[model samples]
Target: MSVWLPTAPCTPRDCAGHLGARRAPLPAAVLLTAGCALTLLGVACVPAVLLLGPAHRDRLIRGWAYAVVRAFGVRVRVTGVTAGEGRSPVGELVVANHVSWLDIPLVATVLPARMLAKSEIRTWPLLGPLAALGGTLFIERDRLRALPGAVRALAGALASGSRVAVFPQGSTWCGRSGGGRFRHAAFQAAVDAGAVVRPVRIRYLTAELHPAGAAAFVGEDPLAASLWRVVTAAGLTAEIRVLPPIPAGSEPDRRALARAAQSAVASDSANRPAESVHH
Candidate 1:
């Protein structure tokens, strides 16, 4: 079992001043053991899919993943999921604020969706296999040559009755302190596909589990320890607020639609802090 260290430089000022005391490193043995077990279990499910077909297998994998996270003590509470109404039957893109790496599994619990993942994730040891099985679409954000094909693939997925999830900010942040500006490529793809854009706001109610902006890999904060932090907090609530879906033609251009969606999420995040409900 390997214990991963935090990648971001933690100066005495950053850690000692604001963030709470740096506790002893978490128990790596338990964390890695559980991670390996879950990975193996996920791998085992691949062959079983031959008997269960693609759709059923996907649901099973998603359920298993969600259960694993919860079992590790990450209690995810969702609100405003009802905002997805009238956006179903496919042809829709769900754009949300990226907070933690946990957002992937958390979102999966609510929507049967495929994600637009960073291309580098395609090579992740255990996660890569599971993501491929779940039909995630990988894109190279820095490679302009690859953007066209990636957009086309996303558009096709939406048209074929698959809801695609994109974190338009293009990076993760600690939602409590706010986030960076969102990129508009995902919105452009939505427009091209004639898909409704569903803006979602994700909030991490707990402190310890909140992401440190510069962490290169999230594994540094052992998954179990972070999950425990979320679970045992006064109240554990990771909110997902899905705002009303904006129709493709509702705005004059993609940029306007993107701004509208961003504004919706920002407003929801502000007005409804306790309950992650979207208007």
Candidate 2:
């Protein structure tokens, strides 16, 4: 199958259409095989590092997963992760806005973090296995009685020296429109655990280059096609900004803390001009 390469000297705006028109169907067999191979590689490494235990093992799995995604053609660019005052010795909670499924590997690549994911992901075919290996904590929103235990588990992970990554927005968006309203539960979790909340902003630079909502895996947009669109498109960039940490003592209430973090991320995202296009 012929792989379409966008022509040289093309503007970001024209690149997507040019590439999409010429896109040959990506081989399902190849994509599946590659994903399986990468996942197995991650699983294999787990037993060897038993001495380092769960925390370090989780980090290793996350690193392998990120490498797999990059090898499969997604390019991730991160900023502000290393900037801030740095995390405390007792671990921290990373609160960020969710944008895409890509955010999983994207955040993993930057931080040795564990995420609070929805329960549905635990049953996804290949992704489910990979996420399980990566130590993702799945939450069943409808199970009210189990929520306290879940929150306690999150606190335990932080106490044990693992950075927990949570999408406070609770849902994804195109970033042009606002993301979903921030959920205060994760912030409360942070406060209850006495962990610092590190806010992050994630933005995908694909709107000007690809179809609106092209990266989303909905309707006609299958996962493989979305992956192809992101990989082959010129000027495709996913920017993540990790802002300063907000100590638990700084905010009087969890809701206020959540709002402050959301505002910080939104403000930072708004200031950045959408002009970084790779030719």
Candidate 3:
């Protein structure tokens, strides 16, 4: 199997169950409407935002992302970001485990970087144009012949001091039952560009900090269904843990580097709750 198209065993029926106390229907509807409205507003403003200097543009993007998540009624808790880590000038390959559609905005809140998206997202209804306007790098994950070109594109972006956020897991998981392994393909770009690898860990939890499935968007889970689940799930919180970066040349090859990054992600914050700064 092509590492770029790795499969996960997680299914909506089995792993994406509602595990949290749900909000009343009216509140959920309001949250959903607000979230959708904010997302569309961001899309409409993308053109103007792009005209600003990079620093100003990124600040707006970060704020917009946080607002969108809040509109969905999901609290965000982020930890482990050191001083200047989020605003570093050095090019970095920001890799994370995929769990839900929310993962995109969640990551953007802390690291407003160029997203590495599956090419299919380019054709999505509203998100497609927004992603393009936001400078997302689309990769044809199913086409093995496209791997080299994708790698080159990623490397080119990183070599130019651009932070590129990627979900190296290839597919979303429940974030509880050992997620899929981090495929080595994307790590190749970091190695080629001599960029540092920043591994991030994301988890969805209920108010009591128990692992939550309501936010999972795994196999055959429709996007609308996932959104509804998230908005209605009472007191659900997304936890983002930014682990230490692995310097360039720390590993001799991409495989070793991927393994090292994966090890850090899997071991650093598994089930251990750090003091979080909520946004």
Residue-level lDDT of model 3, residues 1-279, one tens digit each, is 776788888898888877668899999999999999999998999989989987788788888998999999999888887324455556799999899988989998888888999998998766788899899999988899999999999999999999899999899999986588888878899888889999898899999888889999999888888889888899899988888789768999999999998888888764555476876
Number of clashing pairs per prediction, in order: 0, 0, 0
TM-score leader: 3
Q: Which segments of candidate 1 are over 4 A away from where they belong?
A: 1-32, 46-62, 82-87, 207-236, 273-279
Write the residue-wise lDDT of candidate 1 on 1-279 in tens digits: 111111223322332121322223354335445645776686667666547854675577557756655544345666775523433764878888876666776676666578899887777767678778767899876677787788799888887877889888776554544465667777788888888888887765434655333221132344444444433333234556666789878988778988988888887854764544321
List model 2 lDDT by residue over 99-162, tens digit each: 5667776676656577788787788766676667667888876666776777888877877767
Model 3 TM-score on a 0 to 1 scale = 0.95
After superposition on all C-alphas, the RMSD of every candidate to the true structure, in Å, is 6.7, 8.8, 1.6
lDDT of 3 at 43: 90
Model 2 per-residue lDDT at 141 = 66
- How far in Å is the alpha carbon of 209 misplaced in model 2? 6.4
- Judged by TM-score relative to the true structure, which candidate is superior, 1 or 3? 3
Q: Mark the regions of model 3 whose C-alpha exceeds 4 Å error after superposition.
A: 82-86, 270-274
TM-score-sorted candidate list, best first: 3, 2, 1
In model 2, how large is the Cα lDDT of residue 236?
Answer: 44
- Could you estimate the TM-score for every candidate? 0.74, 0.75, 0.95
